[model samples]
Target: MHSLFILSVMLSTAVAAPFGLVAKRPLDDRDWTRSKRDGCPAYLTEGQYEFPHYMTQVSKSEPNLAFGPQYNGIFTPNDVSTVFSFDIPESRANDTCTLQFIFPRQEQLKTSSYAYEGTGTFVFTGYNPGNCPGPQTTYNNQPGNGPFPQFPPIHMEPGYAYTIDVGPCSVGAGTCVAGMTSTNDTYFSYFQDKDSCPIGIYTSYS
Candidate 1:
């Protein structure tokens, strides 16, 4: 009975996604390059930079004015950047997963800055799983794909992984505040829970 409940929920989610959760193929070595693949960024070439690189920055509140750059104060707004690479092994090529970009608690920011519930965006770039269709515009990847095809949200295969380039995107477009730098962006690969071909990956850019 318990299993049936879970199955029902999964089915519901699959029905919601358009692409469906199954894939016809996996990316090969040639698939990873620009010549063979269309929509690759200018920075991506035959053999130069790799797939993943970290993007980081730091800011604080207080009033030292000495520690790098002050954003909202050491307590107002802060920023940090890092890169990560993942390997999705062929063994678990057909599973479901999700990549999330967590943010600092609202209470952690100054009262002046703590204005909304979800008021930030993360800038992102890098190689996208071949299953995801696109010309690869904007730092934030949208209209792309994730692991789960049928489900609106993306899913990831347990073993197979892709690298992403991430960074802190400035908010408001105004000058950097005393202690706040901006927000972080991230992407993800996911497996939709719809059909038989169950392995795939995509990213998040908003």
Candidate 2:
């Protein structure tokens, strides 16, 4: 009877899917039905996306732990990364888009020379399941933790804007959902806004 009761309790508390309530569904990567085009879509307008609080941060070691504005990462020094999402509507599927990132000039630590100036980027196809970044999101607006991010290809600059054609990553459109990974570089990294400037990854169509 004791063993049976323990199993029953475990079954009742499940994660996502059939665990308890909310259903976690993977991104649908169905083959696109629309014809591929060489030129940009006639209807494609410029897309500039920015998240003020951004979504939260994530830690590779502790996947489930939450860290944001107030708190840092999972360690004393705290290893954290921010994930930016570019959620294009299903209406704008099959559209070629540009993935660009901008890190303002003033955000970095004042120095004669530094390595964090040359940052990196990565792309993914998912969205954050937790709440958006905010005062309530985490401690010290540090950066929250969720899943993990990987990227060794994209190279970025500080105060200068560079873009690349990464789409339609949403091959079939299918309510294209993509993300940009911001991994740590130096002790003081870029990406965080300056005094009044906003630093982030942008999605634009031209």
Candidate 3:
């Protein structure tokens, strides 16, 4: 009877476990940089640069894990883009999920030498496979105003792979400093249970 009880408890714990993914930097070139001759802006580029990747905390006691492509270079006005694609489990197809973009806090940015304050426009798009489904969902926002802009809860189709495109644009006068700093790690968190997300992930700013 005790063994049965233990099995039931384990099952329930697994069911209640949070489902999500964290963003991370590349391992090989984890500490590299781009210069003006190498495509970075002369005035904006400084310090070490790293490739963008997705990460997840597989174990609570361990640090975040990194995955996905290792795109080189920096985020410049001419090319401020990064893409992350992931698959949703079939079990989550009916469940409501929330997508969030997590940015480093202002205090954290101050610690980085390459950090800069400026206005920039970012375009986010979710694409369906093969273009079979027309009219994909998209979100656009200004990153300079604040951090943690999130999309409304969505019902994602299970067993399907979805791609998220992040394109940052510089507005007039101000330079778009998206993906500019090495100290800053931009994260995209996917929550299967919306309530499981911490209060800090939600922001009042648009």
Candidate 4:
């Protein structure tokens, strides 16, 4: 009969995929309780907004793709290694997301010379939130903020730990520059301190 209706439409399209809608009733521990717990949304997703568009080169400025040089991932001219990422949602269990890369302190204190800086960090953790209570820990922000001094939590059963920072510009001139990685670590890099003096460092991923 048409090969059994093409194997029942390929098993009904794999049971309406989407990981088959998960949850086959198995969440023990009082059904994984967690009611009304707020205080973990410092900026991620709803974390980028700046406007004033209307110009034709007003002294040329506005090339701050988070840290200038088109975020130097090196492909020509002059590189400064710059890359970032975010997009984590496997169901978002126990919710907790914070992402900020605001590095532009008065344009790195007015260009120290050539302009370049340094910073690096990383952390991520996921899986099993349906039966939580133990095996839970997190950190990556808390310490005047910038260049993580406290790190731990980069294990989501897939991949993590993507840190890179090559530089030589730290004569106490860091107007603004921050780092913290783990959107499940796909890639990361930070190296732009050409003597300092470049603005635009606003990135958030939740």
Candidate 5:
């Protein structure tokens, strides 16, 4: 079975989470410049930049099956883990800014009877030799995606955008590989991916 998990994963009551386990900044349209993804800036600056993921990888005993990251729908059920590759322009690398994985809720998968559980502890890590998603990046890539901190799962409701800040480590690292896995495997925890596609996953950095 899926035994690998972060120390923070634990049994908890079900309720809406106003805040996630990891730090998430309020939608502050402060001094940050106009949000856009025209191209890499001369250097890192104080602004929220939008970027799309190049590719995604899923790990499962069976190949060619849709689940986890592979599923046009990112349900993240079972023991499946996923990785997303992003090509951070050398100029975009910086230690001060944070890299965030943004997942917009498309629809609710579970029914009204289904009690939503907070997402179990989510572990985000940096893959070595971070390269843009390619043929080599697969679901079985658990070897080098590690040595990162685990954050408690967050309660997610539809209509709101969820953000997972993977830290600045991948900011300057060219071909940054960001990975995610849930320690909690429950109906309420990962019920976000039920019917429609949630592949609109992207990243935001400032």
Candidate 6:
């Protein structure tokens, strides 16, 4: 009886262990560039150059201040945006995953001069070989709304690619800006419950 009880406990522990996947900039080769908005300098283009949207990779391990110059110290309020994409491995097929754009704590933001009061939105879309739809999930972050906002989880299928569009917009009539800290790192993370999968795991942006 004792052996059976021990076995049951072990199984319960395994079931409760959480596991998931993660993809970050620089490390995963998910670089950011400028988006098209025009009116900007020619050699200053990166992602697209139509709307002042820029994308550049940043690392927690090193300094990346030289990437986006014009919009430095501040992510343009509503006028600029960034994009990132990653692939879902076949091992996690048909798994329900919670997607989150991780950022530094509120206290960290408060201490940085680069921080701004605004609402940041993340749009996530899942795509397969020949099937692609509108955004599957959208997460919005507002000033004084805590460090992490509640974003709806998503179900991810194996062999599919995902794209996350992150943009910041002004809050109401006031200009909204996102602050950055020298010691803090920002990236997207995906979580999967252990009960629904074979293993539990946690991943970091670095």
Greater TM-score among 1 and 2 belongs to: 2
In model 2, which runs have C-alpha deviations exceeding 4 angstroms? 1-54, 68-78, 107-150, 172-176, 180-184, 188-198
Candidate 6's error at 199, in angstroms?
24
lDDT, model 1: 0.21
The local distance difference test score of model 3 is 0.20
User: Per-residue lDDT tens digits of candidate 6, residues 42-153?
Assistant: 2112321112112222232233323332222222322222222222233333333222232222221222222323232222212111111112311122112212221222
The all-Cα superposition gives candidate 1 an RMSD in Å to the true structure of: 19.3
Give the clashing residue pairs of candidate 5, or none.
58-139, 59-139, 93-172, 109-194, 117-188
Model 5 regions more than 4 Å off? 1-20, 23-50, 63-73, 101-123, 129-133, 169-171, 182-200
lDDT of 3 by residue, 1-206 (tens): 00000000011111122222222222122122133233211111122111112211111122122212322212222223332222223333333322233232222221222222323222332222111111121112211211222221221111111211112211110211121111112222222111111111110101
In angstroms, the error of model 6 at 179 is: 22
The residue-level lDDT of candidate 4 at 138 comes to 16
Residues 1-206, candidate 5: write the lDDT tens digits: 01111111110111122134444333222312223433111212234443334334445655444333332313244544544444455565563233333232323212212233334334444444353344555555442533443344554433333344434533334554444444335322222221232212344455
Top TM-score hit: 5
Off by over 4 Å in 1: 1-82, 104-119, 128-206
lDDT score for residue 184 of model 4: 24
The sequence of per-residue lDDT tens digits that candidate 1 reaches over residues 5-107 is: 0001111112123232233222333332333333222222233212211111222232222232112111111233112222333332232322222121222
The positional error of residue 79 in candidate 5, measured at the CA in angstroms, is: 3.6
| Global lDDT scores for all candidate models | 0.21, 0.31, 0.20, 0.20, 0.35, 0.20
Clash counts for all predictions: 49, 17, 2, 17, 5, 27
Query: Per-residue lDDT of 102-184 in model 2, one digit per residue for the tens?
Result: 33344322222223422333222223223233434323432232232222233344444434234343331332233324333
The list of candidate 6 runs beyond 4 A from truth reads 1-74, 106-114, 119-206
Residue 5 of candidate 5: its Cα lDDT?
17
